[model samples]
Target: MAAILVPSLLEVLVLICLVSTCVSSKPTNKIKSLNVIKELNRKGKYIGLITVTATEENAFFATGAFMPHSKHPFVDLAGRRFFVGKVNAAATTQQLLDHFDLKGIIHFGIAGNVNNSMSIGDVTIPKQFADTGLWDWLNPNATWDPSSYVAELDFDNYNEPNFNGSNNLLGHLGYETVQFFSESGDPNTPQPLLWAQVSEDWLQVAATNLEGIELEQCVNSSLCLPEKPKLVVGLSGSTANMFVDNAAYRDFLYKNFNVSSADMESSAVVMTSLSNGLPVIVIRGLSDLAGRQSGVNAYATFGSLAARNTAKAVVQFINNIYSFSSS
Candidate 1:
C-alpha cells in the first residue's frame, strides 16, 4: 500500500509541473504574436502628417471638409502641405505614433493674450507651460498669486540685470515666451538648453511674417533678440474654482511675472510631450488680454483673428521645416 501511494504522489507532481510549463509557454508566444501584429499594423499606416485647427468655425477650415470625420481629414497649406486631423493631445499623440507614425507634432490653436503688448493678431510660440492649476497641490501657499507666479518664472530674463526684470505687469505677456525659453533653452545661446528650440525658431519666423514685420525688434533692442519663439510647452490652466476675474487678478499675474498669455490646455500639452521625450511646439494667437468680464469681450472681439493668424504661422513653420529637410 505504501509503495502504491508514493508512485501516485510522484505522478501528480509531474502532471502539475507539465501544466505550469505549458501555460507559461502559451502566454509568451501569444504576447509575441500580438506585438508583431501591432508593429505590422503601424508600419502599414500613413507617416509624416501634421494636425492643426482654429476656432470651431475654422476648426475644419484647414481640413476643407465641414462635418468631417473626427480624425480623418487632409488639407494643403500654401504650396507646403501636410495632413490635417482632429485629435486631442493623447489621441493625437497615439494616433501619430500608431497610424501616421509622425516624426513629431505641431499643435496650433487660439489662446487668450495675457500680454498687454500682444496685439489681437499677434502669434505666440510658448517655451514652457506651467500647470498653474497644478500649483494648487505643489504650492502649499495658495495665498500666493497665480498670475505673478507664472509671469515671474515664464519670460526670458537672461539679458535683464540679475535676470529679474519683471514682465509681470504685462498679463500673460511673458507666459508663452517664458514657456518657450524654458523648454527650448535660450534661443540666443548655442547649446540645446531646452527641448523645442528648432521648432520655436520656425514659429518665430512665421509670427514675424504673420505680423507683416521684416524684423521683430525687441522692446529692449539692446538685448539680443531671441531667434526662436519662447514657448511654454504645456497645457494652460483651466481652474475648477471661481476667482476674481477683475483687475486685481490681472495685476497679480502681471506684477509678479511678465506673463502675457494664458490658456487651459497648453501646459498639459507641454508636460505630456516632455515626459514622453518628444519634441513639442505651441503656436497660439492672442484671443484676449488677461482680465475679467471686460477682458472676455476683448478676447471675443479679437480671438478669431488671433486664432487665424496662429494657424497661418503654423503653416509657415511647416513649410520652412519641409524646405530645410528637403534641401
Candidate 2:
C-alpha cells in the first residue's frame, strides 16, 4: 500500500511540473515583454520619438489630441505625430533597446527655470546639467549635500564665442526668442524675464551617449513651411524632489549649479538614455522661474507654452533625423 501511494504522488508531482513549464513557456508571456520591440521592428529602421507628460494637463496639451498609441498602450499626441510613453530609467532603457531597435530618441517636454537669465517661453538646449538636487549622499567623500548636482558647460567660462556658436545657427533661423512672463507688471514692479538658448555640443554629446549614434545635419526648418527638421540639443538636470514654488530652494540651485532650467523629468531621461546607449535629446522651455516673487500664476500660464515649444522642437528634431536617415 505504501509503494502504491508513493508512485501516485510521484505522478501528481510530474504533472504539476509539466503544467508549470507549459504556462511559463507560452507565447503570451514572451509577447508581453517584447511587445514594443515587435511593433517597432515591424516598422523597420525608423526614428523613434518619445514624449513624456508628467501631468495629465501637460500630457493633453503636448499631444494636441488625446489618444493612445495602438501598439504601445500610450497616449498619442499631436495627430499621432509622436507616441506618448512612460518608463522608469531602467525599463525605458530596456524597452527602447528591445523593441524599437531605434536609431535615436528625442525627449521633448517642459521644464522650470532656475536661472534668472532665462525667461518664460524661451527654449533651452543645455550643454550640461548638474544633478544638484540630491545625488551626493551616495558618495562618502562628497562635499556638497546629496540633494543636487550642477551641469557644467563643455566650453570654457570665458569662451563666450564657443558657448554662443549654435545660437547664431538657431537664432538666424528664428528658433531663439525670449518669452515674457506677463505684460501686467506695474510700473514699480521689477518684472522677471526668463530666456533659453540652445546648447549645441551638449546635444551632440547627449545624442551620442544615449543612442550610440551620431547626428547629421538635415534641411533647415526655416526653409520649409512644414518646417524642415534640424537636430537640436541641450543639457538638462534631474531632481528627486518636486520643485515647490520656493524662493530659498531656487536660490540654492542658482548659487550652486548655475542651472538655467528646472524640471521633474529630464534627469531620468538623460540617465536612462546614457545607460542604454540610446540617442536622447531634450528641448525644454522655461515655464516658471524658481523664486517666491516670480509670481503665483506662472506655472499655470507658462507651463502650456513650454509644452508647446518642446513639442515643436521635438517634431522638428525627429523630422530632421528622418531626413538624414533617408538621404
Candidate 3:
C-alpha cells in the first residue's frame, strides 16, 4: 500500500508541476508578443502623423511614401519616418507616444467650417486649440453668472436667422474650459490650473513655409469648389465630441469661441502632446459650414474632397518641417 501511495503522489506532483509551468508560460508568451521589436526601437526619432479616420489616412497616404510593417504602426513617408496615430483623439495620441519616440506631432482631419469666410476644401492651421467638450446645462431660472467655473453661451443674444426660439431649450447651455494641474502639483494642496496651447515653433514654421500651396478644389473634375481652396493660418480652433449641425449653435460657436474650424479630435491631440512637452500642430480642411449651409449640410458631399486637400497641405508641411527643427 505504501509503495503504491508513493508512486501515485509522485505522479500527482509531476502533473501539478506541468500544469503550473504551462499556465506561467502562457503569460510569458503573451508578454513576449507584446514586447517592442528591435526594428521599432531602433528607428530613431520619427515625426507623428495622425489621422482621425480611414478616409483621412488614405488621402494622406496618397500624397507620398507609406511603408507599414506588421510589427508596428510606424510608416516611412517622403524621405522621413512617421509614427501614425490611428483614429480618435486622446487614446490614439497616447498610443503613438507609448510606442515610438517622436520629434513632433501633426494632426490632420476634416472639420466643420465655423468661420463662414472659409470655404469647403480650404485648410486652416490654428495656433491655439481648446477642447470644448465640458459643458453645464442651466435651468431656465438659473442665474446668469460668468466665472472660471462656467462661461455661459448666450444663444438668445445671437438672434441667429430663422431660429425658432419657441422650441429652443438649448439657450441655457454653458461652456467649461478644461484646466490642468502641473505634473509636480501636490494632491492635497491647491494648485493653479492651466490650458494647453499648440507649439508656436511648429505653427510658425507651417505658417511661413506652407502659405500658397494650392489645395484641391474638386473631389472629381465635375464637382469643383466655387473658388480655389486657400490655406489660412493663426486662427483659433475648438473641438468637441458633439457634431454642430444647428445654424444657431454654429453662430454661437463662431461668435463665442472665435474659432475658424471645429472638429471632434484636434483638441485632444493638442492637449495630450502639450502635456508631454512635445511640439504639435493641427491642419484641418473645412468639410462643410457647421450648420450654416442653406441646403442640407454639405459634409456628406464634400468630406472626401476636404480630407484630400488637408492631406496635400500636411504633405507640404512635412516637406518644410526642417525649418521647424532648425528654428
| Ranking of predictions according to TM-score | 3, 2, 1
The C-alpha stretches of model 1 lying farther than 4 A from their native spots are 1-100, 137-245, 292-296
Cα lDDT of model 1 by residue, 12-76, tens digit: 00000111112223543545544532443343321122222325225324432222223322322
Q: What is the C-alpha lDDT of each candidate?
A: 0.38, 0.40, 0.63
What residue pairs clash in candidate 3, if any at all? none
Tell me how candidate 2 scores on lDDT: 0.40
Give a tens-digit lDDT track for model 3, residues 65-174: 33333444443322222333222111112124554455667778889998878888889999887667788877656676767453567546656578764534555677
- Residue 56 deviation, candidate 3, in Å? 0.5
Q: List model 2 lDDT by residue over 120-189, tens digit each.
A: 6556666544444443222223343322323221112224565654422211100111122222434445
- The order of the candidates by lDDT, greatest first, is 3, 2, 1
Candidate number that wins on TM-score, 2 or 3: 3
Best by TM-score: 3
Number of the top candidate by lDDT? 3
- Looking at candidate 3, what is the lDDT of residue 186? 53
